[model samples]
Target: MCSASEGQSRRSPISTFSPGALRRVLRTADGVLVEAVYEPCTAGFEGNSPAAGGTAIVVAHGFTGSVDRPAVRRAARVFAQRAAVVTFSFRGHGRSGGRSTVGDREVLDLAAAVEWARSLGHPGVATVGFSMGGSVALRHAALHRGRTEARTDAVASVSAPARWYYRGTAPMRRLHWVVTRPTGRFVGRYGFRTRIHDRDWDPVPLSPVESVPLIAPTPLLVVHGDRDPYFPLDHPRMLAAAGAAELWLEPGMGHAENAADEPLLARLADWLVDAAARPRPAAPDAPRTA
Candidate 1:
């Protein structure tokens, strides 16, 4: 069920190319207003194929990214060819209200998006998240596992970190500086247009690897690039091992939405469509490392 503050505006379409696109302001569980756009499916695998017939995919952007970013829009366009797409701005980014908790409270933002997709009459809903968004997706699926209204039928995490507070790579070190320092926050605000919260996580929420074990039977996919500068190959491997998820280690891809090509996006759409149609298995007693 959508919150009372969640409302739709059909007056402004995303673009002329998308005739039935609707823009909305969704109120998250924590009362943050998130900006979202829904693009109806344009084409399908076959006429009224399952891939295009009943599924809606929610696309979560990386840190410093929003619904209007070129990479986000391009991804939505590609996925819309197979399924209706919902793209949203995380809190503290783009036009959304509130400050970013990075990956902590962002799960609430994703839950709201998933609920909004359900309210739109999509019987099957999947989530595809990149970078920080990927971490949020995994946690959202785990935290809201029992809530039918907020749970995802399928989930794909692209270029996500398996554990938190990692500073193994240069880009991650630079990111930490931008996230933890006053001067860095200023640059993130003015340069990236991202408003990060100053406070640290009091009690850190579940990490991606820990959360993965709780998402079994939901059809999880862990995708990462060998050449990703943000997170190394171990990140995806750890996630896949924990959840028994299907892993795809792309050879030349880089990181996040910027690195996902159209072919890969199309393949993901097909995977989500097929996965959502399958029956969910029983949860395992322990994490699957093999």
Candidate 2:
């Protein structure tokens, strides 16, 4: 998601051969149907070790992005080198059935993807999300609190805003208009091929910064670009500081998934692979009562 460089380039490696992809209509915990593609690992499932064996990766795309997008497929190809890969279009994006709730209800969509990864016999799962999807990954992992099958052992978020309602950049400003104004929504549907619902968040969902604290003990990697127009360095800094997580700030990167190059993704895959070798984290401490 580099600024002008990314926006100007319209090239992606074409997928020549299919990789055992199976299409599925996954119903989220809240009853939304998510269109997903699951590609079994080429190396076979290596059980629950993050190091030597095989794990699974669930790829979450950014706003206006889908599983079929060349970017998403390229990412899947990278992660599939070491594990099973499940890529899905968030509700309201592609063939998924529902209007986008932006990031609020989207956590359910991510949870469903994570659960699906575990159900496929992979003992370890990592959720890699970009931009809006990145925010959802953080919140969804926090919500699990390492308590259920939906728990994602590790998470990597790229170019995600630490908090919401930011309009510091031109792209973000335009994005706000698209999400908040009827005229912009109409444009989003027709111009961007996205279908977002018309509903204000009744009660604001947990912000990404707040979710970071709750995600600790589960390994987290926060990746952002200093050149990214949407969010400044403060965003990833806050996330890393709160979660005690690792952060990688590339020098000239742009937005979310598109910001990540193949080498960067390979490094992330290495991190996830290393996480798989480590033992599962202990259950999160019980919440103390006042």
Residue pair clashes in candidate 1: none
For model 2, residues 1-290, the per-residue Cα lDDT tens digits are 11222322233333521456667899987789998877766555444432323588888888888777777777888887877788888888877989888888888888888788777777888888899999988888788855677888888988999998988888888888888899978977776667888888878888999989888788889999888888999999999999679999998988888778898888888787677557755767432110
| RMSD after Cα superposition, model 1 | 6.9
- Model 1 lDDT per residue over 151-187, tens place: 8889999999999999998788888888999998898
What's the TM-score of each model vs. the native? Answer: 0.89, 0.89
Poorest lDDT segment (10 consecutive residues) of candidate 2: 1-10
Report lDDT (CA) for all predictions: 0.82, 0.78
Runs off by more than 4 Å, candidate 2: 1-17, 43-53, 285-290
